[model samples]
Target: DNYNAINVDRTEQIPMDYTGVMGVPITFLHKYNPRQFEIVDGLNRYTVLDVAGLNDNAVKNHLHMTEIGGKSTYFRVLIKNRKVKK
Candidate 1:
């Protein structure tokens, strides 16, 4: 289940300036408050991806592909904050 763990390094640096869709670590769910954020489809959800207008390349770049031991890892939960934190 480590693969599904929250990536602290990346999550800690999440930008508060953006209001659009964002990909976050699944661990974010631990502290998630539904009233504050909305869960969107993840990378594996093709239908949702199409609706979100995210292609393979865009998703890879936007998600900030990470490498572990030289292999790319995929573990994210797409989300959108109901209210952007100032």
Candidate 2:
């Protein structure tokens, strides 16, 4: 589910059956697929979107948002690097 577009040109042909989200970079890892996924890590600072289902074709990066919060600041890479707490 790695996106070559992350480094390569976003206009190049991508393989189907591949699945990964910019916001939810990892999804449906096993037989325990949940109907809904929340931002348990990075909530609203910056993430592309929520990936619910995997039946769709290869999804290109999209600007998606969610309404849930309370996720820890440690989830933030920069915050974790700075050792900040909330």
For every model shown, what is its TM-score relative to the native structure? 0.53, 0.16
Off by over 4 Å in 2: 1-8, 22-45, 48-86
- Model 2 has an lDDT value of 0.24
Off by over 4 Å in 1: 1-9, 44-71
Which number leads on lDDT? 1
The whole-model lDDT of each prediction reads 0.55, 0.24
Give lDDT for model 1: 0.55
24-59: candidate 1 lDDT, tens digit per residue:
777777978899778765543232444445456545
In angstroms, the error of model 1 at 49 is 7.5
- Candidate 2 per-residue lDDT, tens place, 4-83, comes to 11111121222222233222222222311233222223223333232323213223433122212422221110001121
Clashing pairs in 1: none
